[model samples]
Each structure stands twice: as structure tokens, then as C-alpha cells.
Target: MKSSEAIYREALAQLQRLIEQATAQGVEEAHAAALATADRYAHPSVRMVYIVAVEEAGLLFFANTESGKGQQLIDNPRASLCFFWRELQEQVTLEGDVIRQSVETSDNYWRKRPRETQLAAWVLPQGTPAPEKGESRRQVRQLEQALGFEPVPRSPNWCAFRLQPERIEFWPSGWPRMRERVRYLKQADGLWSEALLSP
Candidate 1:
């Protein structure tokens, strides 16, 4: 049997390859994943978010701290994510504990965003209700006028979160009656273990 570390590396490599394949096939939002989070009460919420990077620790995504998902994550740090590429008939699911990245890391990502996006982040209150239509658009316009070509600073509420997955499963389908599923689970000692599940 392969060591836990080997299985862990294999899983990461497999995910990266799938991402590359999806991009090559011109799949729209190839990096997007459905992220699921729950509040303190265990009510679940799920939405699509772009997985910008596949790091050693896990997957990284950015969002506003004040957003519904963000608030839920704060209240309950456990989360899950599902990535499916219909074009390739492949899916990956991850379950993990979420953690906010360092402020400096968030700032770095913010600096790379387009100026318009930065301005929108400044004016848009992510999880709040807007009674008036185009209110956020109006605010963005006003903010743009005020900034007047000045660099838009990153909002403190906007940051990146990483999902350090304790469990990850990969499923690929093509062969007839040959569906297979592989799962990797992180052990308490920080290593990973691999299992094959009936599909």
C-alpha cells in the first residue's frame, strides 16, 4: 500500500491535472467550485466561488467578510466544496476546516484585482439588502468620481479564506459499469490515508 503522504500528493496532482484539462477544453469558469458552509445552527448554505489557487495547504477563495457565507464560516469554520466538470465527466469534493488567510496575503490579491472591482468592493455591502434597484451601481459611480484615478484601496472586510481539507474525493466517469471513487482522509498525525469507495 502507498504511504499516506504519497496518496495525498497523488490527489493534489490529480486535481491539478483535471483543472488543466478543463481549461484546455475551454470550459467556462473552469476553476469555479460550489462552496458549502453552515451557520452555528447547522443550516447549510452553498454557492459557487472561483478557486483561484491550488496550494499545498488546500484551495483558496476570496470573499467579503460581511457576506452570508463569510459570516457563516466565522460562526462555523467547517466547510465543503464540490467541483464538477460536466464536459469531462469528473467531480471532486472536499471537506475541511476553513481559515482566514493573513491580511497581507489578502492585500496582495486585492492589489492584483482590477481598479473597478476594487471600487465595487468598497461601495458594495455584500450581504445587505438594497431596497432600491441600482443602488450599488450608483454608489460605485459616486466612489469612482471621488477617487478620481487614485488607487482603490482594499477593503478591510475583503479577504481570502483557505479550506484545509481533511477529506477529499475524486470521481471520474467514462467507462461503462466502471465507476470508481477514491477518497483521501487526513489523519490526526497530519498525514493522509486513501480509500476506495463503492460507486
Candidate 2:
């Protein structure tokens, strides 16, 4: 068997490959994950977030600054992410501190988004509200004319968060009641300590 450290390194690399495979296979929610965060009062909530980037620093996702998850992150920086790929029979969990991304990085991503998406971002910073009748459509049209052919500047309150991982666990399911799990945790000096868990 490979050493636990080797397994840990492979687990990280496997995530990138799995993401590519999911995209290639036309999975609509290829980069989706359930992100769990605790609010200032220690209340917890979980929601789906589409991860835009995965790097050594952590997983990157964008959210409205004042949204419930965003506010929770601001009050309590630590969070956890769980990714499950049904087709691949694999799941990955990561726990870490969340850090806001740089303005330039957020702006660059914002530019790559479709114009309509940018408009939508402006329209709904929080979850979409059920406005009375045509009120919502009215806002969309107004935003369109107001934002003609210009990059939607990243909102100061709407930005990206990167999870600076301290612990990572990978699970790959097996036949009929069998499974395998491996965990990797950061050491005091930044190296990762790895272990296998009985399933």
C-alpha cells in the first residue's frame, strides 16, 4: 500500500481530475458542494455553492457580501465543504478558515461572467425575493439599460472566499457495504499528516 502521505497527495490531485471528468461528462452541477458555516451566535447553516476555482490556497467560491452564508463567514471564518460525485462514487470533505479574495481576482472573475449573469447579480444580492407582480422584471430591464456594454464592477460586499484548509478527507465507495477513507491534516510546520480510517 502507498504511504498515507502519498495517498493524501493523490487525493488532492484526484479532485482536479474528477472535476474535469464531471465537466466532460456533461454533469450540470459539476463543481457543486454543500458548504457549512456557523453564524456569530454559533448557529449553523448549509447551502449549495458552485466552486469556481480550486487551488493550493483552498477552494474558491463567490457570494453576496451580505448573504446569510457571507455574513456567517465574516463573523466566523471557519467552515467546511463537502463534495459528492454520484457517478464517481466519491466524496471529499475539507475544513478550514475562510479568507476573502483580493479585489482584482474577484473583478477578473466577474468580467468572465455573462452580461445577464452580471445583471442578475446586481438584481439579487441575497436570494431572489418574490417581488409583487412585474416588479422583478422591471428591475431587470432597468439594470440592462443602466449597465449597457460595461463590465459590472465587483461589489465591495460581493466577493470570493478561499478556504485555507487545515484538514481534508477523501472517501471512495466500494461494492455492497464497503468503503475506504483517508484523512490528511496540517502539521505545526505546514506539512500534512495523513491517516487511513476504518470503514
Candidate 3:
């Protein structure tokens, strides 16, 4: 039998490989796991899900910047994210504090949106009462007419928010009902110390 240290080293190696593969594929790919789990669970909370982008001091969530959710982040910057991929049999849980996106960063992402979507930024009040559909459509049409061929302007509300992760836990479900769990705590120096937990 291998020594406990040897087994741990092997597990750590495998975990590193998986992380590298997931990162190379991008967060969107990681999000696929989240989508699959969300589909299976049919959770309403997952409807507007996003990968938690974290800094040392804040949490971030991104929307059209015109959506009510964006305003909520601006007002209250706390969030928790749960991600699961059934095929891979893995899950990640994250909780953190958030901050509003900087104007320059918001503008950068805003420019990438389609013109119609950019215009929609102005039509929505974000986190407020829903506007009448007919009235909203009319306003959009009017804006289109007024703007003619010019590019749509970014609303002051359009932006991204940043989230700082305080705690992160990774759970990998094993076959035959066995499972493995690891928890990481971020240090002041930005390093993480991981601990294994009983499954």
C-alpha cells in the first residue's frame, strides 16, 4: 500500500491536472458544469448564474449593467456561487463580497455588446418594477429612429462588478457513493491552504 503522503501527492497531482484542463477551456466551459447541474436541479436561483470572478477584497458579477441585478450588486455586494458538473462529478462552492466595476472596465465590456443590446441598456431600469412591454418596445423604436446610424451609447449603469472570494470548497463525488472534499482558505498574502474533509 502507498504511504498516506504518497496518496495525497497523487490526489494533488490529479487535481492540478483537472484545474489546468478546466482553465484552458475557459470559465464558460467550467460554467457548463454549472448549467448541467442547474438543469438537473431545476433551481430558480440558477436562472441568471455566472462564474464568480473574485479579487482579494471583493466579489464581481456582470450583467448588461442596465439590469436590476447589476444595480443590486452596486447597492449590496455580497454573493455566493455554486457550480456543479454532473458528467465530471465535481462541484465548486464560492462565497464572497462584491464591488462595482470600474468605469473604464465597464466601458470595455460594453463596447463588445451588440448595438441593439447596447440600446436595451437604456430601456431597462434594472432591479425596479418591470416596464410595460408595449411601452418599452415603443421607446426602443424611438431610440433607434433618433440614433439613426450612430452607435448606441453605453448607459452609466452598464458595467461589471468584482467579487473577492473568501472561501472556496471543491467536492468531487466518487463512484459507489464515496466522495472526496477539499476546502481552501485564502491567506492575507494571497496564498491558499487546503484541507481535506471526511466524505
On lDDT, the leading prediction is 1
Estimate every model's Cα lDDT from 0 to 1.
0.89, 0.82, 0.59
Query: Per-residue CA lDDT of candidate 1, range 132-158, in tens?
Result: 888878889998999897888889999
33-94: candidate 2 lDDT, tens digit per residue: 99999998999999999999887667899888788998899899999999888877778899
Candidate number with the higher TM-score (2 or 3): 2
Residue 118, model 1: Cα distance from true site in angstroms: 1.4
Off by over 4 Å in 1: 173-177
Poorest stretch of ten by lDDT in candidate 2: 2-11
Q: Model 2, stretches more than 4 Å misplaced?
A: 1-9
Pairs with steric clashes in candidate 1: none
Residue pairs with clashing backbones, model 2: none
Residue-level lDDT for 3 in candidate 2: 61
Instruction: List candidate 3 stretches off by more than 4 Å.
Output: 1-47, 52-60, 63-72, 173-175, 188-191
lDDT of 1: 0.89
- What's each prediction's TM-score? 0.92, 0.89, 0.64
Cα deviation of 168, candidate 2, in Å:
1.2
